[model samples]
Target: MNLIKKSAIALCALAMVFTACSDDDNDDKNTLGDKEGILLVTFGSSFPDPQETFKNIDNAAKKRFAGETIKWGYTSDIIINKLRQGNGEGSLKGQIIDNDTPQEALEIMVKDGFSKFEVQSLHVIPGEEFDELKEAIHAFKEKYEGVSVKIGRPLLDSDADIKAVADILAVKFSEELKDGPVLLMGHGTPHAADAQYLKLQSELQKLNPNFFVGTVEGIGFDAGTTSIGGILAELDKLSPKATKVTITPLMSIAGDHANNDMNGNTGESELSEQSWKERLEGKGYTVNTVMKGLGDYNEINKIWMDHLEDAE
Candidate 1:
């Protein structure tokens, strides 16, 4: 009887050893498993107000791409410097924002064992900034072997995107459109992609003739048609002569351009450099300014999210 008991005990020990070996193999497979990370790149702002929009975007991305490690990258060195300083008055007072550049964020992700990466740009157009981002992404790809990298296009990359954005804007400012014409201020670039603003303008006009799109830089390939002066000239040709106008920023964040350039006053004289608001008011048009950015709209954010999805 004692011999039989010893044999049963030895059999149980062998079974336990086999189960432990199987568990170790599975653990090793999981340790070297496929890992993915997402990097959201944008021309970041220095102000605190835009942080809310960023927060909303982060939340949306987290909800959509759950279980994936997410990170942020700011393209603007000036803004990043100011944020790091954290000693300026007003917006920058007592605020320390730590953000990584596109290259830095990707490096960190690679160090964390993420072999697959998806980069999403939050710019309104594929302008100079987006071009630079693409270059950076390309360099990153060349530097890392066996690492998969994909980048999403900007907000207005294709005809469908232009049409979709115009539709959303038309609906967003439906009430404002009823009151008067709406003038949107975009950040223009000398890049060939600047023509996107013109395309967007055409689409917006198709939806509503009162929609006018202009740029602050006024240095696009077709400057004559996309500049602020161009928009003012078109406004002059209005048959009924729009007496009231609603001015807003078409940028991702309503930063310096929206707050100061679009709505700020020089306060020196009417002859000095004038904001869009002042310029419109000079024409005897009652101007209503909306200090909201494109990022403030969930519908607009979804379009960006869709671009990321396509990239993935």
Candidate 2:
């Protein structure tokens, strides 16, 4: 080939390479420029299946708010430390890195120049954990005056939220409610805000007469109210001749409490302590434990998405 023709061909090839590199660089720049994001905050769970709860919520948020980024933060320090120290459960070992405390996650996001943050709490009630998350967001608002940080309400934050969640659970567990009473287990708190659970129970029972709510903590019971024990007592009265009971976690994720404390088989003799399943079975009731978190349900997840929209 002539020298001039060969030179022209080489120039065209170099130009093509340059154009490809330019397009790749622009793509990275565009991704970085989209700074608005959702910081999904949850009380981290060590259970492997519950890890998908975060992913599900994150995916929903991303779909609802397309073009926005998504990050995760856990409210528990112990879970964060456990995962960081490489001591989480076998299935969760490699899946817990993003499970840092909300503060750590927020700070990291800010450092990365994420200026617009929608902090969505995966907490069921507006209890201690939700309060702490709100406080963190407020602190961030003060410190980073230029950044925009808006807080999303917990699942049962308002009267509407309570009613909506009740309706969703009622439908999700309708089959069990048809056969036997359905009992939901929540991680109740000692905080005064534990009153949220009582309100939630009221709304749920209104939807299904046999639906009942209980807490791991006893803070939710009062004059006319019921604790877990109280709910169990009510169950006995409601079904004096009943032989079957259905139990499920009312929390966002069916983590340790759901898997072990509530449904651990008594046959695992090393962990021989009787769980809720054993306790109910001991009461002569055939217990059917459902290993599902509230977040596992799509309608329940949409409630959080709705809260995000309302907050926005």
Candidate 3:
């Protein structure tokens, strides 16, 4: 071939190679390094499934931040106790449950070296606990010179959250038990939590007439209002011969509260596995603890799909 023609072909080949190299470099720049992100935060799980609460939160995040990278972190001590694995040999089994206190969780995340953060809490409301979580996030963001963080609200406890929860749990009630009583256990606060309980009670009643939904809190319900004796007294008044009743927790995850406080027995309780089965059998109504978290399936899913798409 002629020298001029050969030179022209060589120039074109060089141009193609340059273009390919530039594309590769751009791909690397876009997908790797500080450009990638992770969302770190968790909700307060009430045990056995402390790990599961993070699992629910992580599932939601993965859906919300599909293309973007996200690493779930816990904010609850209840969960840390059940932790079995982490970023180690059996890393695949390593869930997000952690042994870190509020401050320690942040340190671990910083040590892993992330740059951008979108913190989402599974809090029921932007109440005291939620506020504390927010403070923690802000502190972390400020403490870490280069980290970016944003907070998300609790799904179930939104203005319409109680309503949504009522709808979700109404499915647990049977038609035959339309007149039977239903009690929902929630981690109620001493303050605004009463409002949440009222809201859920109202919503559940509207959804299904069978359940007169009421809440028992670590703070609110005592033997007078929520004390086991008071509740049993009312149950006797309503249905002395009633053969069955259904109880469920209104929290996102049914961990310790559902298992222990709601079901546990020191004197007389039915549902807690640690307690006597006879206590439940003696109750006459036949106690059953609902094993699902509010964020169990569909509710958790909506958060994930919606958020991930928005993040994209």
Q: Which stretches of candidate 1 lie over 4 Å from their true place?
A: 1-34, 87-97, 219-225, 269-272
Cα lDDT tens digits, model 1, 1-312, are 999999999999999999999987654333232579988888888776777778778877888889888899999988777766763225643322246789988877776777788999999998899989989988877676567888888999999999999999999999999988999999888788888888998999999999988888874334543666677788899888888999999998888788777898866575766888877888788999888888889999899989999993
Per-residue CA lDDT of model 2 for 1-312, tens digit only, reads 699999999999999999999987654333233377778888887668887777777778878989887888988988888877767666763353386777788778866867778888889888888878888887766666667788888899888888888888888889997778888888777776677777887888888888888776653356333455677677778744567889999889889888876787756476476667777887888988888888888898899998888774
Predict model 2's lDDT versus the native. Answer: 0.79
Model 2, which residues run further than 4 Å from truth?
1-34, 93-97, 223-225, 265-273
Ordered list by lDDT, greatest first? 1, 2, 3
**Per-model tally of clashing residue pairs:** 0, 0, 9
lDDT of each: 0.83, 0.79, 0.56
The residue pairs in collision within model 1 are none
- What would the TM-score be for candidate 3 when compared with the true structure? 0.66
- Superpose all Cα atoms of candidate 1 onto the true structure and report the RMSD in Å to 1 decimal: 10.0
Expressed as tens digits, the lDDT of each residue in 6-87 for candidate 3 is: 9999999999999999987654333222544555555544244545656766766676567766555556654455453321
For each candidate in turn, the TM-score is: 0.83, 0.83, 0.66
**Cα RMSD (angstroms) for every candidate in the order listed:** 10.0, 9.8, 11.5
